[model samples]
Target: MNENVVVSADWLAERLDEVTVVDVRESWEYDGIGHVPGAVNVPFDSFRDEEGESESAERSGSDPRDAGTLPGAETWADLMGEAGVSADDTVVAYDDTHGVFAARFLVTAEAYGHTDLHLLDGDYSSWMREHETSGDAPDPDPTTYEVRDPEHSPFVGREEVEAAIDDPDSVLVDTRDDWEFEEGHLPGAVNLDWRELVDDETRGLKPRDELESILDAHDITPDKRVVLYCNTARRISHTYVVLSSLGYENVAFYEGSLTDWESVGGPIETES
Candidate 1:
């Protein structure tokens, strides 16, 4: 994994005042359970659209698939602005859910052209074990976050995913549970649960060699373009961060994922 994308607790502790720490947990958890000092709360749900209320639906008529879709770029800018995060600020995001939600936040930030993004190596539980916490919320001074053209597109649409089904140089990875994959998955997609990439105890990514070995066993190599997806792109976000941090240059995620796939009658293969 790239050292830059995953920061150790010690590293964060040293630079706590220099970086913007975001807790992607819910508001209740942020207040009830305490968080890293000076951390801001930006729930993972902020990146998504409400069911039947997406901006896409407003423009192109309502489609069930539009629900939970990623909102437009301006919305993302507003989210960052409301959270007092500027585009140039170095962001370190964390959550209790094994960094899955935190990874989602990082991916969204990258999509909107934020360059310096990192995931706290372990979950809040691990951090609490080693670092101090605070129940007092910081009153962040909001800033104007201007959205610019993204340097790289980390999200792929349904059409691109459809074409990838037949592209030998591309691979579609279903980062969901075994039972979920067994029930049904995209044609030619391989199952590699997102949990497999995380250390069960630390709730952080596994050791470098172990991660490489796991990916190698699944034939997910750096040379090939990788497209990851889960039910609604939440679970796959974790794998996307892992692949990108591992120096996979051609990695992108299906933002709509299986929810949109099934909505449009996209082909699915069941493990029999």
Candidate 2:
């Protein structure tokens, strides 16, 4: 497990020149409070939508705001290229959302076969709290990314998720908060709020033993075919990294999450 991929604010600060610090927050958020000195802004929204102009999605009347909506590999490649991220550069992504958006950027990058990625453990807020400092954003340099075909990646579609519900070896994890789970979630999907696996103060992961015990209590073993989902498929990125770090090899991200499930009249369970 390369869990060391997550580095502290000080660690990143020390190697500021070595790794490319990427701010994954929205443009407004980036401009509002500033960012890591010399860090480039690559809003995580680009991974979900193509700058509000998804041709395929537009024809389907699909809102990019939906959880499962992700742009094609070419579009993602172009966006990353625009962000001035070279393939060989070590990428360290951060955002205000407790590293979820940052994780989303990493996972999406992995789909393109880019592996040398890291997360700024506490994100910008964490940095502000710990180092008591802030930095200004820089204009991104445009660089081409040699993207691997995303068709070979590990993302899951709605139909596959629906079918996984019946697969004996598979488990569907609703990675949203408890309230959202109680409202409505995919049938047979077990609620496991992504937050339970994280430390609020540090914004870092819980111990391996603790995470293991928590997941084991829910029968979410490492060998099971784990399918994880959340409201907009962003927060689920946190649990994805958690599971991956814990050595879950068969994990998959269900992009179309609860919203898509409900759109198709899928069966859902409710606490109330």
lDDT of each: 0.82, 0.75
lDDT tens digits, residue span 81-175, model 1: 88899989989999999999898788777766788899988879877989999999998898999776566676667778889999999989999
User: What are the runs in model 2 whose C-alpha is more than 4 Å off?
Assistant: 1-3, 50-67, 130-134, 150-152
* RMSD over all Cα atoms, model 1: 3.1
lDDT of 2 by residue, 1-272 (tens): 14567778888888888888788888887778777877888887667754322232223233222224566667877888887888778888898877888988887777667777787776687778756444456777689888754333557667688789999899889888788889888878888988888778877777779989999987799889999988667778888877877778888786666656666677888853
Among all windows of 10 consecutive residues in model 1, the one with the lowest summed lDDT is: 56-65
- The ten-residue window of minimal lDDT in model 2 covers 56-65
TM-score of each: 0.91, 0.83
Candidate number achieving the greatest TM-score relative to the actual structure = 1
* Segments in model 1 whose C-alpha atoms lie over 4 Å from true places: 1-3, 52-68
Provide the lDDT at 96 for model 2: 81
User: How close to the true structure is residue 211 of candidate 1, measured as C-alpha lDDT?
Assistant: 98
